[model samples]
Target chain A: VDAGALDAARSRDASLTKPPGSLGQLEDLAIWYAGWRGERPKLEAPQILIFAGNHGVTAQGVSAFPPEVTAQMVANFNAGGAAINQLARCFGARIDVHPITLDRPTGDFTEGPAMTEAELLEALSLGWAAVDPAADLVIAGEMGIGNTTSAAALAAAMFGGNPRDWVGRGTGVDDEGLARKAAAVAAGLARHRGELLDPLEALRRLGGRELAAMAGAIAAARSHRIPVILDGFICTAAAAVLERIAPGALDHAIAGHQSEEPGHARLLGALGKRPVLTLGLRLGEGSGAAVALGVLKAAIACHSGMATFAEAGVADGPG
Target chain B: VDAGALDAARSRDASLTKPPGSLGQLEDLAIWYAGWRGERPKLEAPQILIFAGNHGVTAQGVSAFPPEVTAQMVANFNAGGAAINQLARCFGARIDVHPITLDRPTGDFTEGPAMTEAELLEALSLGWAAVDPAADLVIAGEMGIGNTTSAAALAAAMFGGNPRDWVGRGTGVDDEGLARKAAAVAAGLARHRGELLDPLEALRRLGGRELAAMAGAIAAARSHRIPVILDGFICTAAAAVLERIAPGALDHAIAGHQSEEPGHARLLGALGKRPVLTLGLRLGEGSGAAVALGVLKAAIACHSGMATFAEAGVADGPG
Candidate 1:
């Protein structure tokens, strides 16, 4: 989408009976939707897809925990131990976690996409088919150990940018862990022979199973005209690949928050996106986006419900 | 109220199901209430009060806008022009705006309470009379122009804090404006003699009418054993005056956020209260507290709702 559609959305936003630009990025996000859908954005209900998988890069001793933690954390998320779970409840958004082929070590760098090509498509089809299809908005979040390496490698291969520019500390890595992770990412990109084709194949080579599923979900979100929120670094990385396969795919993507990871901002900037808040957040697992989602939804509500000064008979400061 | 009680609240917090100390000041705020009510704190329909007034000290040219903007903004607050009004809807919190007193140059600052003594008592009585007996929490927020100075002076005279320590640049004033405001505050304190024998007497001297009403609401919130949230400089200033009249009143007070004001930290420290969030917010009119209220409620939910590793049957660390 060019600036024209965005402009159309803004005009719709301006007529929402609130102060001009007072609703901030929320009005902008909704306006973007208005142009895409050819109607004013209405925040009826939002859905979130949380993709869970183990990374193929942790074999390099990148993370403090093992791949088994991934399965356990999945249970925790479903049971509401994680921040994202609480956020979903708080914002009244429904979240469904989708598992993308979990397999044991090829070291912790488990080869992703355990399903065969045809089977992978079938699995993705089933998952998307399960969604009730009436959701007004969508967000994709990923949870897997050592996933940032997978994200960076996919980001580098997909964006045609320096692999080094795409690497950063994932969770709690110091300078040393970051350096090691970057080197591993470089090797993964080289291993793929720079061949970033079908997303599942990319997952099998340089990414993780969760990434492939998330990419499909992002594409689905775009096709559905629902604003898909990018959660933390890895979600954006997959978003980058999906955006390339289907140009203008990112038009539906909203960068939720800036990550503490060095490369996350670069990824966001490369995609021409801006984050809603910067709280020095380093925790991933959709925490950043989950918090940001509340803001987005609140902004939408502000745009939709607030009475214009004219309607309220209050004077606005002169332009 | 005492070290022992505060310690008990802190100890109860560490035992909650979520990550240790993860709920932030919400954990502390809850604990503070445990001391107040001698039980765990749950935010069951918390109520917030916002009072509106203008300052006698404003004639010194300390603010970026005219004092009349105070009343204008109060009307805006009631009609939902500022962020706080939207936040009130977001959190399902109730708010009251009292147009109490102003610095209109013609009103006699020395003759009477910001409101009549009877009016001050009636507002306090009204606050006392309004709370739901079954409510689990309460919060007080004040919206007064140039009221930060009065709060500081009130703090200095009654709370036994230094004048410089209690004063702060409010609503984004320049250095020169802040200096003049500080001087006027000192003069006001000298003129009034800080007589706080009655809450109304305090109002007549140094308190904005809205500030005094806020102080009454704070007293009511404490007496009810419902947590009262102090937003930035103005609310905290009013809280200090209320506490001076009722020394045990700090029992349920919770500083909502660490504001950008120079004296906010000092005021919070004097109360032995730590703010739930440090967002550098200095804008008054209950916006800071209102924004923090959602997160605080989330924190309560986290503490009360999350399952432990043992209950969830998830591995805590490396197995």
Candidate 2:
């Protein structure tokens, strides 16, 4: 964070016409944004990257939708017919859909590692290269039928929680499917025990290609000083790998929303990230982050647009 | 509200490409908005009315700022320099500021009634007339130095709560100012005990002109089928008067945000309102509601703009 820029923003916020600290979280958020975009920031180009890949764990009956739905959703995204497309339109953000080998599903983590080293590298490089350097903000989302199960396994392995605690009803799974998801998570952990010690190794072993790609995109965003809005459970779990590998790696990121998934709250708690919105959103594809994009815009609009008390000729109240 | 429109929106939501309830509160908010604007709604015209008044209760030292600051802020608003102005620009909303008798402050509620019946009616009429019938959405906000004290007294008189519970650090009041606010609230309730049995009488006795104006504007919005986004503590207290007199009078209104004021949560609970945003905002110039406008716009955009599963040629999951 740019300490000078943040201090300048704080001083400017106090000088605004309204009472000091009356805007609450918005004040802090604007300063945080200013830290990245300088004292006066404009959110002109926010990019939404949705990485889709097929999950082999869907064959274990761990999700409501079949694996083919991943590619179908990717096509839907490409056609600008998905929920994220509407949200992108709402924020005037550009949307990019990357389908990472939907024809070849990752190895079922319950049997072995989800991705080979080369496969993980390919997805990561694709995501790393996909970022637009000119974009002011980035939102990384994922689409995979059984990716939430993979997310739960990754979170449980990374944070040392019970598999059942990290599992949730992904894509409206029934009780049977929920149990199957938990079993799949536990099996994945058992199959890849010592190999999961390294966080990147954990991503290769337990996370799908789309998940690794999200991690890569988040890291790329950090490298470019583009603040990121982390999406739902799968997206956060992907970003969690980066945080585990290097502390403070996600300083440029903020959680978009606390999803309906139960593990989402636990993961956010572990990450010490308070989401910008909490409308019980669980639909991935960067929808929650896309929704929160308006909030960040509003915050910045108030910060840069509103006249200070001295300029407005308004009396400053004594605290 | 139009029941047919709401039902149509609900039906349309289920057919969208995402899971049935994956959108969560946004799905419900869009359906409610549809109830007011019909099944196909466009939120192009959102009008924000800010009512400013001077409160005599400031003589009791119940606020951080002097009462004269009300007129100064009103001038700031007129110059398009206030926080609400920036938010209005962000949403393309029009703002009309009405300063009611700022030269002649309302009578101190602790000493006597805040306004006579005629004075209350004048403020109410001004607010009712301020609403633009062509507007698709309305937001009512208030600006008064000691208005939170008036709001606390009104809430205490109407809802039978401890005055201390309703009193909060409005605009960064210190401990001494908070105590004075609570004492004033208790005195106002005691002085107008029998008169406040009627809700409108409570507004006349304990509420300031700005609060009554907000109540009037909210009622007018409801009459026009223009859904309202109620602001912080003072604004909600004003709307609460309508709900008290006529049960479900605020059916067209939704809370925009939970403010930093502690009483707001209790009042929202009593009114059966779940705020769309909880950013700890304490500014009373309709700023909270103005910030939440983006959230509503995003919801409506997703509801109306996203493609249905059949339209997108995507496979619908079992969910």
Candidate 3:
């Protein structure tokens, strides 16, 4: 973090017409932007990159939707017809859909590793290459039918938590499907217990192609000095992996919302990030992150637009 | 609430590309608008009315800022120099500054009633008249020094909570000022215990002129069929009063954010309203509500703009 920029933002916040710290987290948000940009924060040309892939875990019938739905949703996103599309339109954000592969799905983690080491590296490269240099802010979203099971498996293995504790009904699955999902996660963790010791190997073993891509995108965004906004559970799981692989990579990222998914809160807590919005969102087409763009815009606008106490001739409170 | 419009909205939400409850509170917010408008919700010509007044309780040193700061901030708001002004500009909402009385602060409620019954009624009328008929949405904000003490007093009297439990550091007051504020609240509650049984009497006794005006504006907006977005702690206190005096008056209103003020959550809870934003905001003057306008807009847009599964040729999940 840029200490000088953060100090400058704090000084500016104190000079604002309202009481110091009265804006609460907004003041911190503005300061965070300053620290990220190392100057006055400006939000312009924000981009939403949706990474879509198929999860082989769906063969276990753990998800409410079939794996084909992933491709269909990606098409919907490209056609400007999905939730993320509407949110992007509302926020004036540009959206990009990148399908890792249409024909091939990752191997079922319960049976074996989700992806070969080379495939994982290629997906990561694809993610790294997807960043738009002109973009001021980047939001990473994911689409995969059984991605939640893979995410749960990754989180369970990485965090060493019970699979049942991390597993949740993805896409409003029935109780039977939820049970199957949790069981699949437990099996995957047991099968990859030794491989999970290494974060990269764990990701290759349990994480999906979209997860790898998102993790790469996040690390790339940080390297490019562009802030990243993470979507819900699946996206945060990817972020957790990135954090383990690259310590402090999340300094450029923020969680968008607390999803209805059970593991989202734990993942965000592990990342040391607090979501700006909490509306029980569970859809994972980058909708939550896209929706949060409004708050970010408002915070930036207030930070840059409001007059100082001296400028407004308003009396400052006596602390 | 318009049941017909709400039903239509629910039907529309069901047809959207995502699951029925995937959008969570956003889906409910869109339905709220439909009910408010009795048709498709349109958020055009939004107006933010800021009611500024002074509290004689400031003489007791319950606030970090002096009473004069209220009028000064009002002038700053008129000059487009305050946080609310910046927020309004960002959200494309019109702002109106209404200064109740610069010279005459409300009576110290610890000693007596803040206003006479007639004065309270007049202040409410002023608030009601402040709403523009052309406004599609109304937001009420308050600017009053030491008003949190007054609000805490009202809430304590109405809800039977301990004064210390409801009092918090207003405007970043130190420990000493918080203690003084709490003591003053307890005293005011003790003095007006009998009068508090009647909600109107409670407002006249413990509420500031800005609070009365806000309550009036909220009631008037509902009457005018313009949904109201309430600001932080002080603003929601007025809504609580409105709810007591006129049952279901708050059905047309939604909380903007959960303020850092300790009593805000309790006040919002009493009204059965969940704030959309939780930025720890304690600043009054409708800053929270103005910032939240962006989210409301996005929710409305997504509710109306997203293509249904049928339209997008996307398959729905099997539950």
Candidate 4:
């Protein structure tokens, strides 16, 4: 964050026709943009990146949907026929679909490491290469069956909590499926308990390809000076890994929404991020991030377009 | 609320590519729109109506800003130089400013009724007349200096709460000013204790002309078949009075955002309304409502534009 830009944004907000701090979080959003971009931020040329990968953990019967649904949704995204595509179209953001293939399906982390270090690196590079430097804002989303289970496992491993506390129904699973998912997460944590303390090792052992790719995308976006808006639970869990591996990696990231997933709030809290929207959203095709772009743009418009008290000849409140 | 449209909306949501109830509150918003309009809702023509009035409550030294700021802001709104104007522009909504004048600034509510019954009716009619028949969605906002004091008094009078619990700083008031505002609310409630049980009487005695007009506009919008979006605390306070005066008047309304005012949550709760956005906003003048128009439109666009499961060849989830 740039101190000068933040100071300038605060000064601008105070001069707006409304009372100081009257705009509330909207004012803070503008200041965040200024600090992130080191200038008055414009939300032009925003892009959405959806990373898809098959989760080997799906073999554990953790999700209601089949693993093939990940590929099907990726194709759905490519055909402009998914929720993310529609949201991007509505919000005027370009959409990119990146499909990451591991050496094979991750080795079912309940029994062994989800992916080898080489495979995780390959997935990360794929996510990194997906970033478009010219974009002003980048939103990272994910599509993977059983990814929520993977996310929960990763969150538990990173934060050291009980698996049941972090597990939630993925794709509207039944009670039996939720129990299986929780059990799988606990098994995965136990299998990799030694390596789980290290964030990168946790990604290799307990995280899916898509989660790794999203963390890489976050790092790539930050390096490219493009602020990233993290999608729902799965995307945020990926960010949690990034933050652990690299301190302050999430400084350029914003939590788009509080997901309906039970662990999302705990994950976001650990990341020190406040979601821009909280509509109980849990769909993870970057839909939450895409919808939040409307708010970010409105905040930017107000920050840039609103007339000052002096300009409007409106009397200021008592100092 | 129309039962048939709501049923249709639910069916439509299920047919969409996403899982049932995947879009979270957005699904409810679409259903609300359908029920409000008695058909599929189209957000093509949205209009924001800002009702500004002066409050005699300012005479009690209950506000941070002077009473004239209300008129100044009305002028600012008219000049397209206010936050509401900028927001309306951002969301592509037509903005109308209606300034209401009382015979005097309704006698200080602490001393006497804010307005005579006849005057209150006239103000309501002014608000009613401001609603544009062509608008598909109507957002009602209020601008009145010291109005928060009036709002708190009205809320306490109708809901039987302590004035201290309802009163808050109107626009960055200091500790002394907050104390004064609470004292004024308590005084106003005492003066109107007998008549306050009747919601209409509460408005006449403790509400401002702007609030009366807002309630009128809400009733008018419902009759005209235009869905209404209620702004922050003051606006919701007006709707509370409307809901009490005419049962189901708020059936057509959506709470736009939770205001920072402490009394706002209780007021909306009393009306059985949940605000769509919660950004700690208290700028009023329908700014929160205008910003929310962006989210509403995106939801509408998604509801109307997204391809269905059959159309997109996406398999439905297991029931």
Q: Estimate every model's Cα lDDT from 0 to 1.
A: 0.64, 0.91, 0.86, 0.84
Off by over 4 Å in 2: none
lDDT per residue (tens digit) for residues A195-236 in model 2: 888999999999999999999999999999999999999999
Please identify model 1 stretches exceeding 4 Å from their true place: A1-42, A76-83, A103-133, A152-204, A240-252, A258-285, A315-319, B1-41, B54-86, B101-133, B143-207, B240-284
Score chain B of each candidate by TM-score. 0.80, 0.98, 0.97, 0.96
- For DockQ, the strongest prediction is 2
Per-residue alpha-carbon lDDT of candidate 1 for residues A217-257, written as tens digits (9 for 90 to 100): 77776666667677778888877876666667687778877
Q: What is the interface RMSD of each candidate, in Å?
A: 5.2, 2.0, 2.1, 2.2
- Winner by TM-score between candidate 3 and candidate 2: 2
- In the range B57-142, model 1's lDDT, one tens digit per residue, is 66666565566656666677677755566667877777666565443321224333345566556656655665555566666666
DockQ of each: 0.15, 0.70, 0.66, 0.59
Model 3: CA > 4 A from native: none
TM-score of chain A of each: 0.85, 0.99, 0.97, 0.96
lDDT of 4 by residue, A200-285 (tens): 88988988888889988889998987888888889998888878877888888888789899999999898899998998777899
lDDT of 1: 0.64
How far out, in Å, is residue A166 in model 2? 0.8
